[model samples]
Target: MHGKLTPGLDFLSDGGEMGALMRAHDWSTSPLGLPERWPQSLRTVVSLMLTSKFPMFIAWGPELAFLYNDGYRPIFGAKHPHALGLPFRQVWSEIWADIEPLVKKALAGEATYHEDLHLVMERNGYPEDTWYTFSYSPVRDETGGIAGMFCACTETTQEVRSRAALKEEQDRLRELFKQAPSFMAMLSGRDHVFELVNDAYLQLVGHRRDIIGKPVREALPEVEGQGFFELLDRVYATGEPFTGSSVRVGLQRKPGSPVEERVVDLVYQPVTDREGNVRGIFAEGYDVTERVQAEKSLRESEARFRNLADHAPVMVWVTEPDAICTYLSRSWYEFTGQTPETGLGFGWLGAVHPDDRAWSAEVFRDANAKREPFRLEYRLRRADGTYRWAIDAAAPRFGSDGSFLGFVGSVLDIGDRKEVEERLRESEAAFRTVTNATPALVWVSSNDGNIVYLNERWYEFTGQRMDEAVGSGWTAAIHPDDLGRILPYWQRCRETGEIYEGEARYRRHDGEYCWHAFRAVPQTGSDGTIERWFGICVDINERKRWEEHQRLLINELNHRVKNTLAIVQAMAAQSLRQVGDGSRPELQAFQDRLFALARAHDVLTRENWEGAELREIIHEVVEPYLRQSTRHFEIEGPRLRLIPRTALAIAMAIHELATNAAKYGALSVPSGCVVIAWTLVPDATPRLVLRWQEQNGPPVAPPTRRGFGTRLIERSLAQDLGGEVRLTYDLAGVVCVMDVPLSDEGGMLEHQSSH
Candidate 1:
């Protein structure tokens, strides 16, 4: 039936009619398996599916028959009917330029495929770039011949742009790894073989090329026996990461040669799957050989220093720059009787002697502030409650940056030496006082003969100030005429340490010369070293003049005594000659005896009357009588110095005996000999006894007369010298024995005479 329509309805009626015709065609082709009817819902479903959120499209062969999809409407917005049933190249020429090749390949029975394709297409008259992954497949007829191309595809512009950005990020990561300084590697698989290694890793292993896909041990063979492979095995087995500080690794360039070992700080990181199972490991490390060695050397040096401090004899201590002690050696405890803990810090200051504390503190403060070495003497209190002198020396310690770190010091005991020095000073002062108080001029000179010290008497004698006479100044006061001799003598005294005495003229205060007796003796130390000279001088002018006068008096006395004795001898001889008038031989013998006494006295006086040798005295008295040249005499006694009176008396007594012998007794013939010997008897009161014997002469008889020879022999020595004299006329010979008292010979005689 024909239907009438309004103008607005006609427009909707035309679309409805077209829809009905499509449904009618589908219903009629139902047996041919065509769609039964184009339902209103079916049209709406197709439209919604094409315009879904994702970009979607449908194409047949090289043509776009319908473009209900929202993705395609933009490409043919204003050109509708012209775009329908047109080749895709004719509707969107720019997009079809690339899409046409993919469509032809699909139509030629190629399998469907998609790729990232960039298309510049006009969208509402604006050119736009669109990326897509459009796929095409063959639309076959019932007979299986290629009929047309069917396509179902989506635009992939956002995904393509995102993938490009990800690639850029990966490339940047690769660049960073290439330029890295440290060795870096990626390890995978159960064996922990390297999957990838950077250039730095290759260089570190000294490998010229890549070491990818090789086991760690095979690639870095140098690390086989060094336990690195074992470490890697452990990490793989445990699936744990490890970080090491200063690990040692040995690497060798040649087999059997010394390895190039290095110290490194390293980290091993475990790469895990999403399930947290470790699948690989990553290694990162740096060579730290130099730093490790330096630190080790520093530790060794510090240990050596500690050992020295522990064993030192002196008290070694360390303190902060603030003067607070930090460490004290073992010696500190031994010397101070305090433990290390008690001696540290300012505790040590408490042990200082009160008298020295203030000064020591001041010195320490100044040295600390100035950062200077400190040396000072102080007294430290000992365990015995006495303060001992100590020398404390310290030097500042500085850090590497030149900042003052602290101080190291030592303390040494010097109390004994200090006491000795003090005693020496006191002794020197006492010596000075004694020398000044003496009446004689005294001075002490240096080893070089320069006057170093002098008594007050020296200044008084020379009239020079102490400063003026010190050193060589004393030479100025020496008399010019005596200087030549005195200076040489002074030099000899200094060089040889000999006692020196010399008479020299010295210049007095008024510039007049005076005769002074100078005497000097070198003062020596215990080592026989001459330290200085002690000298004394006295004025000897008066004593010298008196000695000269006494010489003349002595000469005159000797001459007078000799002349008187000679006259006495002459008178005695005359008397003897007179008594020889033919009848009294005994009287003549008495006169001869008197002459012998005078002659013996003359011999004793010539020997200074002190004493005479016994043998000499006997020879002189007996020579006239014996006349025998070989008369043997033996005299044995302690060496004796006898008084003058005893010697003279003994001489006279011997002379009388010898005279008797020559005249009528033992010595009348040449065959006779006399032997005289003397000895001293040692006792509280010693006595000298002499024996005289004669032999080979005529038989002797007692004389009847009291002759002068017998009287002189017995009386003079016994009475004058306080001794006994005996005369014997024995048958064998004439024997004379005399005993003289050693101690009061003359004194006893004088006492006896006074009584």
Candidate 2:
């Protein structure tokens, strides 16, 4: 069958597609001529190349004609048929420069070989990158001389690209591992050799960055017997993953340093191939030393707290933020005879007295919901099945992270305290009976200003029932005009916890408004804290009327007194004018003194004869001097209230001082100024010190004899004031000091004469 396919070319027979084409090809135009005329060595080589299943090609004669087998046809791509009879260089013209030298060497009998050599070929319509593992070897002639070259090749483009892509992916993964936040490492083989590690791994291992390429046991010698090595071995042998949390491991972080304790959370995953064989391990984890230590400390603290609570005198309890009881101290169990199973959650409420259980639960739940502290007084069932009052107090608890944890509370037995309180209540009833029998309208108010008690007299006077007059209801009995002002004043005193004294008109049961004197004193506890306001309301309408009548008479008296002084002034002027004698100046001086006294009387009357401000008196006396030029005097003083007698005396003294100053002192000159300043000295005996100093005045000298102005200031003023007065005459000016004692309550320090 082979001989029939091509009679003169056995090498071209049975070669599949390429063989069939070669059999019909017209090789007469080729430099090598027809297949029948070819040399035996060339024919034998072509036969060998065509018979082989591997890819093979041959170049023949000086033209180096290209010939290839069926296995090599795909390598030529679209150029397969046409490339058969072309020159070898022309068939691969795109890579001729790269292959020409190799072709020459093979032809010279050197026989070169290249594996996976790079080449650019135009076998297709366009140029492309191609790779191949091919060899070039000389084909010998019948005489054993080199005739042409032979080549066996395979296109390796896919394989080369696959390898490059795999390397790129590996590099990217390595970079990701290096920059990972947690520690990561790769161990290669069962020995657990550190093949790769990231910076995080270095930090976890302390000062051991040069750990790669070393076995785990050798690199970290201190971790040898710490069970990590055994864990790794187990994982690799069983081809399983191992996980650890808060695992203890000792480490030598610094050179020649003591072994330090450490803890970690880690995973060891076995690395394997397609055969399910364990090849290496991939490790990833976190250093959890600080977290482990904190947990240990927390456990110890809880233990200590439990120990203390067990021995405590009072019952202690703990609850979750949801108000569910979680813990109860030994005292609670011993006192209540309750076991843990019957005491947790809302079960503890069963031990409370039936009357208080509902309200106690409500108070506790409400406080828990709002995360607030609370206090409660309730009866608790004792172990002997008897009830006893208890004071329970608790405050909200929180975690270090500010999370609401729960509540811690304590409960103390207060049965004795309750009995004492009962006795006090009976004593209060007896006291109330006595108050009711009295003629006064007695009442009691809470520290918060709520009326808590009212005797029979109060209800009888106000014509109101207990409910109608208690708390704020009695405010209706107050005259509307006084209600508004008294309510705020009463509330202010309550806030200050001070005594309250106020007058308000009270509407009587018969519908008439009457003045009432209200007085309330704070009733304090043993701790000195106000517990209640004990008060009384007294009827003062008759006294008020009498005071009003007296005030009217005083005003009438003031009017008559002013009229009589005016008549006296008129008479004095008329007598002096009629006399027409040298005594006219003296009479005028006397009239001026009377005028000063009358002005003082007018100020005292305006004040209701109680007192007058020293500031008002000073301003009154200086009114005459300020008529022309107000700049002649500088008067400065604090507001001081003086008694009526003292005010009159001080006013007269100031009048005399100013008169003398105008005639012979600082006020005597236009440019001269007087500093009239007074200050109150708060000493053991508070004193009012008034200073009158003259400046820039004409030279002054002691008087030849004592005159009325001097006499009035030194004798009358001092005697009426019951204080001292100093008058000094210096060449520069005249200075006067008026020193008098003053009461801290703004009254007279001593007896003040009306004169």
Candidate 3:
């Protein structure tokens, strides 16, 4: 064996094995120790392999003493040392359990060769199932009987487990891919033919179920020119995954119509083999039409918001949670003369007025910490180094995760408005001071009659506080008797926007009513609308009392003057009667005429010399002389008004005429009738024409006496009223006519008649 072996073999054997092998190359030194460098177990196994045709192993009792060269070290691993001399049951208990029956059968002299035997054994910590064409032949001793069994085996664990795992993984992938909601498919080769298609893919492409294994273009002839086939080819050739979001694809049916397209998100993954060569393409996609449209609309909405913020009159800004300015509109730069970058961080604080810096910072800090909206008014330093009032407001912004991201805010310049407010305050203060200093009560009321403002004088006078005086309650202090009249006037002023002046009594602080001359003037705006009313009330109680006393005194003087006139008329009548001829009848007539004049004066005085009713004057002066049956009189006229002087003159004239008629005309006969009719003349000169007509009496004639009766009628009517009187006595009757102006004896009566 050594001579036949090459140098490579000699090196494997070693020097001691070569020497021993040369001495007893055939008999003394057997093939067992010829390869002395090898272990006894391997040398014995190799020597047996020359005779054994089958792969085999030799074991002593329970220990496997020798295994064939076909068995690699991998089969034993760390169990090699223990298996060389240990009992087979102890060394490989798990394997012994399966081989024990076979070993026993072989030992009973029944030669056995098990073909394609399946055995499960433990190698190291792993349980391995192996397939083997095994032969266990009895190694007979010199008697040619069974001594020990030889075993031959092969492992098939890798092929069996690999086939099983591959089948399981393929089944799992198929089930998962089919159940997916999204469209999925495998395209084979550069032609992009569909090798596999899930249910979702078939549904998406509107394909029949049986066409799944067919090429996509062949199955759906409608999709020939579509871009999707080309896209798949590119992905396959490149051996790279392709992704598309919302890639539109038009259907082939109607090329000119509105394109029927779907927004889809697609991904193509290249399937590769063990050699890293691209084989097929796997595509997964979803319909994202609604989501794509919604995203577009959201972007448009954000654009609109940006436009509004940019163009708004106020300065708009956004800041981060750390108070760093993130955004500022153009208005901010225009107003503050500071760009957004200049105002980043706490740089915006520099623009704040020195007086308002501390307050602004405090408010900013508090709002940021608490994540609340902030609103405050402060002054900001302008480009001109002047400070202007500004209203700053900010609302905190938050992220979807409830983090305080930042804030959105606005700044409005109110400098002009602030100046106007200050001026208004100064004016109001001055008005209040002036009104309070005055002795008269002053108030300002709304157009609706609500008291909006009042001076101290009003409160002092009413014994009420400012609260009580405001609104309609201010009227509570007004005397009840005057409220009716004053309230109407006040309302009129409000409606007409006029000045109101009236005298009324108002209650004082001491619960006494005092006469006050109240005046209110409505204040109007440029549009001619009444906004409010400013009023003043002065105390007039003392003056009113004095005027009342003066009126009484005047009335007494008028009475005395009337009495004196009556006496003068009486004295003149007596004196005339004495100086006249001894015609007793004429003397008596003269006395009667004087008496009539005296009676008229008395009637006028009774009316306070104001005026007298025409009918009343006629009845009073005539009833004393004429019996009801002997004289009949009628008075007819519209209700007419006469001035005091005109009424007196008319009354006296009527008395004189009635006296003469009673003495010498109509009243002397039972058939007599007298009619007194007066009509108002409508003209610039308003006059009253009165006629005293008598009839059915003895022959009538004018009085020859030229006595006081005739003179009195003529003078009273003509001198006092700028008119004339005529008396005529005829055979048929006597008639007297009087015409007078409506005024004091002149055309001034026209103006007087207006009253």
Candidate 4:
């Protein structure tokens, strides 16, 4: 069978893959018989497929033997090499039910055409969805009778899927346009005619059915004069987008309805073609009427506040949230003499005193950072080149949403009041100095007897810490023996607001018990209520001992009186021999010495000779001179004690100095003044230094000769008291200095160290 075919009968010589496969195939056992016996119509179709670039297939004879061109090989998938010369039904049996009618119509001599036809094919071994645009035409025999079917087809599977995907996308876009929350509309043409609108857009325009195909101005005529129509026209003509916020619009829903005003935020975006020609516009917007109205109301309220602040009395100011000044009241400008250009922002800091600017700025910035209120006092430079104290108080401002806005503040000048407060502090300091120097322990309490203040002497004497001794804590420092009764009496005084005088034993820091006379007086306020209690605890231990000694002295008084009388008789005999008249200088001098001795005895008698306060002895000696002159005198020192022998010597020395001062030194002149001060130097051996300085007196020459007072002050005082005394008489005035050792803890000097 292979050797029988001649070249002229060969049907598979021209086509590529399909023709080659057909030639090499065994056709003797096929239904079409041999290639040479095939009909002329089939041969003609085969000749067309072989030379054509398009894909084509033919079926011929009774069994309709299948044939296709090389361009059709891919359409068969994996069945190409084996499908040659097979019957059409056998070759495509999987889709035979779908294609048999189309093939039969062509064989009956009728033509058919299908575009993008759907088919399920298994040419590659498994079923697949496929499509094609093809035509089935009848092939005639030489006698004009239908013989076979011919098909010219192109697979359109990709185009079918693309159209389906495009349809799905269009459906989604239509849904989005209809169901959108904001107002949206589509316009077409240069006339800006409305083509499509969603539900929101319909409601916004107050139109239900009459808007499509109508121009924007004709559909919503009330918006014609509101510039919205003009805006759409501009976007269409220029192909540029326009956006606006809080745009005013008026709408009338029906022919007879009144127009209503509305505010909207909107945009008109042009839709253009690939060549950049403008088509129409896409409109999108939202209603913003409520927000716009609210902002208007807030602006009105702010105006009212500004007016009030402008006329306020104090210096009022406002600042940004970052503490930059934004506004200042008229009073502030007048006070600082600054213009807006110089006072705005941080420039106002220049009005603050140079020393206080850094501190004031720090405090202000810190409060601003925390968004808190604050108060501060600082000096501000006023217009007159003077600095005045100002109290600046400010509070942070916040919005309704609780966000920090800024600060509103005021300043008040307090220069006069501040001066008064400073003076009060100075007065209190002076009072404290006097109380601290006193030997007696002093305390002050509230009307209810809660201790509020204690002098330095009180702390030193009791060895109590300040923090531990205030209020009720002072009770712990009282001697246990005396507190039992003293507490009851103290309560009585506090209740009745009466003067209290009592005796008690107080414990010293050294753990020694001493008798003290406690006295307290209530000071009343203007309302006749007790303001405070001032109390002093004076040491009276010596007085107590003196009383005890006087009892024993009663028996010895007679004997001592006889000895004193005999010594006085001898002294009188010597005075009578030295001067005949009682007015003589020697007699008067002797009497003055005797009187000085007596005054010393008087001080010792008051102290029971245990000790005498050195200050008291000095006061007694100078009392006469102090009474005769109006000179100012200052006496300052801690309280000190003197033994009987030392007290007598110091008393004599003071009397002689006073006598000389009255005659020729500070006391003799109206302008003269005296300052007597003493201090105790604590050491392994303590020493007390007493200085009496006089000023503003007549010039003195060291004294032409040593007078009796000078001799006593320089020689007798130093020898008798075992101390050193120096008397200087120069141009200014007289100055006397005494240095003596103190033993027994400020009691008396066992020896003197001269300097």
C-alpha lDDT (0 to 100) for residue 39 of candidate 4: 72
Model 2 regions more than 4 Å off: 1-203, 207-234, 243-247, 254-257, 263-267, 271-307, 316-386, 391-411, 416-568, 581-591, 626-640, 670-755
Give the residue spans of candidate 3 off by over 4 A. 1-298, 301-313, 318-325, 344-346, 364-375, 393-410, 488-498, 558-755
Which candidate ranks first by lDDT, i.e. highest? 2
Which pairs clash inside model 2?
A: none
lDDT string for model 2 (572-615, tens) is 88888788874677777877888888788778777678788787
Q: List, residue by residue over 1-755, the lDDT tens digit for candidate 4.
A: 34554665676566666666676678889987767777777777888887787888888778888888887888988988678878899899998999999999998888999999999999887999999999999988888887788888999999999999899999998999898877899999978898999888887767555889998767777776677777787888888899998888888755677987888899899999999999889999887676687678878977877788888889989999878999998888999999899999998899999999999999999999999999999998888889999999999988755889999999999999899999999999998999998999999999888899999987888888999888888887777877888888888878888687788877778988788888889999999999999999999999978877784684366347446855885688587876686556666666667767766776776666667888898887777666865756788887777887767777888788776777788888888888889998787777778898888988877877788777777665566556688888868988999887666533463332111
- Cα displacement (Å) at residue 51, model 2: 51
List model 1 lDDT by residue over 570-633, tens digit each.
Answer: 6666766677753356555554555555555555555544355555555565556544554333
lDDT (10s digit) by residue, model 3, range 566-598: 687567667776898554566566556556655
Question: What lDDT, from 0 to 1, does candidate 3 have?
Answer: 0.71
For model 4, what is the alpha-carbon lDDT of residue 556? 60
TM-scores, all models, native as reference: 0.40, 0.49, 0.44, 0.38
Of candidate 1, the 10-residue stretch with the lowest lDDT total is 746-755
Specify the highest-TM-score model's number.
Answer: 2
Candidate 2's TM-score: 0.49
lDDT of model number 1: 0.70
TM-score of 3: 0.44
